[model samples]
Structure formats: structure tokens, C-alpha cells
Target: MGYEWLALAAAFLWAISSLISVTPARHLGPFSYSRWRMGCTAVMLTIMALIVGGWGSVSTAHVMPMVLSGLIGIFIGDTALFACMNRMGPRQAGLLFSCHAVFSAILGYWLFNETWHLAEIIGATLVFSGVVTAIFFGRKGSDNNDWEALHGKLAIGVALGLLAALCQALGGIIAKPVMQTDINPIAASAIRMITAFAAHSLFWASGAKLAKSKNPINRKIFSITALNGFLAMAVGMTLILYALQDGNVGMVALLSSTTPIMVLPLLWFITKQRPNHYAWFGAILAVIGTGLIVS
Candidate 1:
């Protein structure tokens, strides 16, 4: 029971990462930022894995699945999420990303032959309704803070956010079977981060237009980006996997999906303005919906 709290802690760290990432993600652009973040995280995980002898648990058979997971989850999912955050701000992006719980549940039902009762269906509905409500009515006209302002088209942000959520769902599905084995979660995470970093590096070397950074990385931005990587991927993700080792999957997902709600006060503290009623209501609705599904 106490171990389940790891999921909540992970959610809190992720909320903080969202705040820390805004500047770097905005400055470097999503693709470049993700590349740098993955590289930093890969190094950190690799060192940690070595220190703990976590690599002993890994096998050649686990490589491909981990690669796929990293490609879909870290490479695409993470980039899309930050891109969405760059446009819609962390509050909206976080809410949309929380839909990963719904996506994960649906995918689990389909792929694992897991049966869902009526509660899950209602939960899914509430999650969707919450997302819609928050996106449409989350902000007041008086909220003119840059963090609350939309950077680009709302439609693009919404699409990117949903894409990130779907990719996250797919990533988890791909990794679940492999994770049931005795492989070390730290080593597993290291492999995924390395795979993602390679993918990002390759993309950058190919000179893709979108891969270009909006501004050159400076010490300040690099430090913040590295810290974001450490918090979000190295620690935050590892915590979720650790919790999943002992906690119920549904319960873990339900707890972790509360990142949006957890970010509200952090947003208020930083921005010096409370989120509107719609924001609070929508976040609560989504969490409640997740509770019903996982309960």
C-alpha cells in the first residue's frame, strides 16, 4: 500500500518537470529539446545502472522491445508533449497528456484481453468530458499571464497532446510483457533512453527542418534541460516502474494520471495567479474518472 505512493511522487516530479521544461522547450524547440533531454537522461540512467549492476538482468531479447518503446514513447511521445506544452502551456498540455490513463486502459483491454466493466466506460467518458471542458473553458479573460496564454493554434496543440497520449499508451503496452520478467527496471529505462537518444541524434544529423533549435543552447538552458531530464525521465519514470513492480497497474496509472491536478498549485505559485474554476473542475473530473476505471 505504501509503495503506491511512489506513483503519486512520480506525478509530482513530472509536474515540476513540466514547469522546468517550459523555457528550454520553448527556446530549443521541441525536437531539439527532446534530443538534448534524452541524451542527458540516457547518460544518467546508464551511470546509475552501472553503479547498481542493473545490467546483469538484461538480455538480448529485451533490446528490440525496449527500442520500440523508446522510439514511440520517449522520442515521439515526449517531443509531441513538449510541442503541445510549447503551444498550449503546461496546464493545458498536462491535462491532455493525462488522457494517457484512458488510452492505457483501452489498450490494455484490447491487447491483453482484459475485461472492462461499466465503471471503466463511465470513467473513460468523464475523462474525455473533463479534457474537453478544461480545454474550452479553463481560462478566464482576465488570465493574461504568459503561462496561461496560447502560443500557437489551439487545434494543433490539442492534436499534438492527444498524439503524445496515444504514443504513451502504445509504449506502455509494448513494454508491459517484457517488464513482467526479472529485468532490472533501471537497466530497462537506461536502454530505452539510449535508444531514444540515438534516434534523436540520427534525426538531427539528417538535418530535418523541425530538428533545428530555435536558439543556441547556453549554460543556463543546458543546466535546466539536464535537470528536467533527471527529474522527468531518470527519476520520475523510474519511480513509476518501481511502483508497478509491487503496486496494481490500474492503481498506479490512476495515481500517476493526477499530474495535471498536482501541477495546479505549482502553476499558481509560480505564476502568482490561481487557475480558474474550469481548470480545477476539469482536473478533478479527470482524476475521478480515472479512479472509477482503475477501482
Candidate 2:
């Protein structure tokens, strides 16, 4: 299949992984989950890189960018995302995380001197409007709820989601420059995973001591976390690398941002939490916007 198609597959897998992650995330703290997830991804990708002979071409010149990409995208991005999921629930968090495309587009333009067409701008605006509208209007609780209570964790979640988007955007831009060098994408991804694993380990070690006595890391959570990590690395990173190989960063980012659309249906089917009219409208708009931008 074409690189764009690969990217689309990657996005779909990521969406499925995200939906799967929510169940385990509910049981485990975001930090703990993120720690294990990154660790597993690091191991899995390392083995893949070695098996495919992708690691033989790695060099020092590619090290920093790859490491930084991992630190920003995997460590910070996933950690913030999990935190958002814990605070805002999956739907709201997913909507907010969709802003990653916009951030990535802007960053790609600034960093790579990529040009944006009017159609792209219009499409992105539509997607952003749809996602924000869904988030604001489709809240679960009643209006009488105090702003302090309703806003606290959810607001934090949104902010963190925005931060994660920015980090991912920056990391994507960083990865682009390095991809032009001698380093192969798979090896670069492996390097990134290593740094991410280290950072996550530090976080986990520091936090584990203070975790509540009843903290649970059962078989189900472990399995899901492992699956999430493996798919994210093996599929998500591979597709992203391929997309960057033949596509503009803005287009690739926008296309991949459709993941939430892929995910929402799974969430609805599994949980029976049907989205309201506004959410459905937003999802449609998002899909249209992504198509226009990518086209």
C-alpha cells in the first residue's frame, strides 16, 4: 500500500489503541500506565529495528533529534494524554487532542517552510470548530453544576491535551529534519523509544513510592498497556515515518488526526455512551475537514 494508506492504517490502529487504553487507564494512574506503555514500546521497537536491520545505519547526528522526539512525543505527549483521559474521560480528551493536527500544521509551516493553501486553512478551521463545539456543548452534566466543580479536572485535561499537541507538533518538525539525514526512520524511532523509556522509567520510579496503598496493576491493565504500547510503536510510528517520507508534514498530521473519528465509534459500541447530536455533527465536520486538508 501507499505511504498515505499506511498512515491511515496507523491512525486507525492508534484510535483503536486509544479506546482500549481508556479501560485500563481508569484502573491505573496515568503516570504508571504511561511508564509501562513507553517501556513496552521501547522494547518492542528495538526488537523490530534489530530484526529488520534498521539499527545498523544509526549515527550520532541523528541521536539528539530522535531522543528529543521521544522525550516530547512519547513521554510528554502520552503522559499528558493519559492524564487528560483520567480527568476528562475519553471523548472530551480525544476531541481536545485533535488539536494536534492544527499545531502540527502551523509548526510544519514554520519549521519546514511548507506552504498552506486556503482550502487547508478552511478545512482546519472547520475541524477545530467542530471539536471545540462538541467538547463545550456535549458535556455530560447539567448546567446547574458549579463552574469550580465541573471545570477543575476537565479544564486541566484540556490544557494538558493542548500541551501534548504542541509537543507532538514540535517533535514532528524535529523528526523531519533528522529524517533527511542518514538515519533510517525505524532506527530513529528506536532511538526515540529508548529516550522515552528512560524518561518514563524515571517518572515511574519517583512516583511509585508515593502511590496509594491500594494501587492496582492487574493482569488486564498490564495486557492493555502492553498492547497499546506495542501498536503505538510498531504501527503508529511506522506509519508516521512512512507518511513523512512521501507527504508534507501538514497533510500527514491532518490525515492522522482523523484517529479520533476512528475511535469514537468503537467507544460508543463498547460503552453504550452514545454521542449527542452535537458530537455527531462535530465528527462529520472533522472528517470533512481532514479530507479537504489532506486533499
Candidate 3:
């Protein structure tokens, strides 16, 4: 499969996971949900690595990058993202999250000398434009353009969302050199998950953030959390590594940044209601832009 498909699959899988996750995230609080999810993923991936001989290829060199990737991307990035999604709905959060592509492109060029074409730039622009359109006009009522409807907490939420994007972008770039050496993407993802879980554990151990943890006791809720972790970390992050292995990092970010676009219809489906007019338009534009970039 092409990297574009991998990126798209990553986006869709994330969207599905997000749809399932928001409720638990709200109940457990973002950090708690993130920490536990990473823990689950760490265990699952560790088992996977043992099964697939991913451990044999590990080197001292790979360890640092994998850990850093996990810390930046999963620990910081996902924690902040879950908080942002809870503070602000996914609609606004998605638009802000698109900034990851720009951050990734700039960092990729500066750090790794990744280059882009005119067509790629155009496609990226369209993708962002579609995301904006969807977000601005896709809400249930006339309240579109979240950037315009700013308030005290909402503004903070937006900042958190942007921070999450930046971390995610940086994490992706940081892991690139290691992955380029032909490391198994699953192993790479698993290693990152372990490192991120370790980081989260340290944070919780500090006794300050423990107040934020809800400590899920319900088996069903725990199951949901595990499932989300498996989808996002096991499946989604692995696909992300696979995409970054050979795909233009910028294009991959832009293409996969369509999570918000995918989420609108998902929200409608879950809510049993029709999405707003602009959502459909934004979805189409995002698809067209992604297709163009691939072409």
C-alpha cells in the first residue's frame, strides 16, 4: 500500500477511536485517560515486539529517538489534544490541529531537508482550507468560526490544541531518521508507547497530577480505553510510522490531518442527526486535496 493510503487509514482510524474516546476522556479526565491508554498500548506493543522479533533490531541509537517520539507525540501531544477536545469540541480542535502539517513541513525542511513541490503546496492549502470551512460552517447552529467565538476557556483550549499539534509534528520529525533505517514500524511504535508510558508514570508519581486521575474501575470503561489505545497507538501510530518511513513528511501530515473532516459525519452518525451544509463541502475538499497531493 502507498503511504498516502497509510496516512488516510491513520486518519480514519484515529477518527473512529476519537469518537469512542471522548466520553471516557471526559469522565476520566484527559491526562488520566491518556496515561492509562498509553499504558495499555505499551503492554500490547511489548507483546507484539516479542512475537515479531522487533527487540533483536533494537540499538542504543534507536532507544533515544523512540523514547523522545513517545514523550513528545503521545505523552505531551495526546494529553494536550485530549484536554483540548474536552475543552473545545473536536470541530475547533481539528482546525487548530491542522497546524501540525505546517509545523512538520517547516521542521522537516530545516532538520531533514525535506522538499515539496508546487502541486503539493497547493494541495496542502486546499486541505487546510477545507478544514477551516468545515469547522467554521459545520456546527449545529449558526455558531461557526470558533476563532471568532473566542472566550476565556475556549481560547485556552485553542492554545492547548495548537500545542498538541506542534508536539505531534516535532515527534514525527524526531522519529524519522530512526525509522528511515528500516526499523519495523510496529516495533518503533511499540517502543515509543513504552517510553511515553514511562514518562506518564513519572508525572503521576510526582503526586501533583494524581488529582487529575479518575481511576477507571468499570470493566466496560476499561475495555473502551484499551480499545482506543489499540486503535490509536497500535494501529494508528504504526501506520503513521509507516507513512513517515517513505512519504513526504509534510504531505503525510496534511493528508492525515483530515481527522476533523472525518469527524463531522461521525458525530452526525453517533448523534443520529444530519451534519451541517458546510461539513459536506469541507469533507469533499479535503478528499480532493488529499487525492491531488497523491496524484
User: What TM-score do all the candidates reach, one by one?
Assistant: 0.89, 0.86, 0.93
Q: What is the C-alpha lDDT of each candidate?
A: 0.83, 0.73, 0.83
Candidate 2 off by > 4 Å: 1-3, 133-152, 207-214, 293-295
* Cα TM-score of candidate 2: 0.86
Q: Clash number for every model? A: 0, 0, 0
| Pairs in clash, predicted candidate 3 | none
Model 3 lDDT per residue over 132-250, tens place: 88876777463453322443486789889999999999999989889888688888998899888888888888886543666554778789999999998898989999998898788
- lDDT (10s digit) by residue, model 1, range 1-295: 3544687789889989999999999999999999999999999999999999999999999889989999998899999999999998887787788888778777776777665468866876776677556655766752587877888788999999999988877777787777778889999999889999999999999999999999999999999999999999999888876776665454456567677777777878988887779877977787788667556
Error at 274, model 3, angstroms = 1.8
Candidate 1 residue spans exceeding 4 A from truth: 1-3, 115-136, 246-251, 281-295
lDDT of 2 by residue, 1-295 (tens): 6555666777788888877787676677777777777778778888888888988888777788788888998788877887777676665677778778788877887777888689977887776776666655655542332211233555677798888778777778778877766666777888887898798777556766523222678887788889988787766886797678767787677767667667656766875666567767877887778677656
Superposed on all Cα atoms, model 3 deviates from the true structure by an RMSD in Å of: 2.7
Instruction: Return the lDDT, model 1, position 126.
Output: 74
How does candidate 2 score on lDDT?
Answer: 0.73
Q: In model 3, what is the error at residue 210, expressed in angstroms?
A: 5.2
Ranking by lDDT: 3, 1, 2
